[model samples]
Target: MSIRLGNSCVNCQKYEDHFCQLHETTVGTKHTCDSFDMRAAIKDDNNCTTCSRYMSATCPNPKKAAPHMLCNHWAPQEVA
Candidate 1:
């Protein structure tokens, strides 16, 4: 998790709901910019370690996933 996280707000410490706490502006869950800082408390499925597939069973892909890895299959949970 040392590397920059996928340049995403959902994984940023500055993200507060739909707002960017750092920029003081609205943001999408997938929105990102130069200021993205990974959240320390992040345990969302965005990463392989927290992914349901990795937790419940082995990953189906040919390559193994790293802790901070993001894959094409990642789908954000719907906000309802």
Candidate 2:
């Protein structure tokens, strides 16, 4: 399976063990099937400002961003 860094599956709700939960089968990370539903990343009250992928006010993976600008790969930055 070809897995990419910014694949849609990284944040998909149905993504489990590189498998598609809805399809009940394994799927390639690079694959975007018809059932593809973008998953929203968990956000804090501060929102994108605290996201790991938020760098210099730009998102490395724009496709992962929801209409509201929330990203699926938005992980909270670890406290230094």
Candidate 3:
């Protein structure tokens, strides 16, 4: 799927695990696709709304501004 950052998150770059600098997820290879960095984490049944990592005001991902509304990129996925 083509994951385009909408106006909500257009102000930032695509989320990269390395951007956090304080935290990183283990990616298997360098040649992997863009979606490779998205890791599956346990999500609340209510989607990103009740998700701590998502609604967090302090998340390092540039797209933290993205809302909890239903979107193609809102699903929980492991970063490995």
Which structure among the candidates has the greatest TM-score? 1
Model 2: lDDT to the true structure: 0.59
- Tens digits of per-residue lDDT, candidate 2, 1-80, equal 85334545645677877788898877765666666666665233444666666654557675554433655555657621
Each prediction's whole-model lDDT (CA): 0.66, 0.59, 0.38
Task: List model 1 lDDT by residue over 1-80, tens digit each.
Answer: 35334767877888877899888999886699987787675544477665556544446652666778877654333321
Give the Cα error of residue 47 in candidate 1, in Å: 14
Error of 3 at 78 (Å): 3.6
Please give the lDDT score for candidate 1: 0.66
The global Cα lDDT (0 to 1) of model 3 is 0.38
* Poorly placed runs, candidate 3 (over 4 Å): 1-27, 31-46, 49-52, 58-77
Tens-digit per-residue lDDT, 20-56, candidate 3: 2223433323323333333343234544554345655
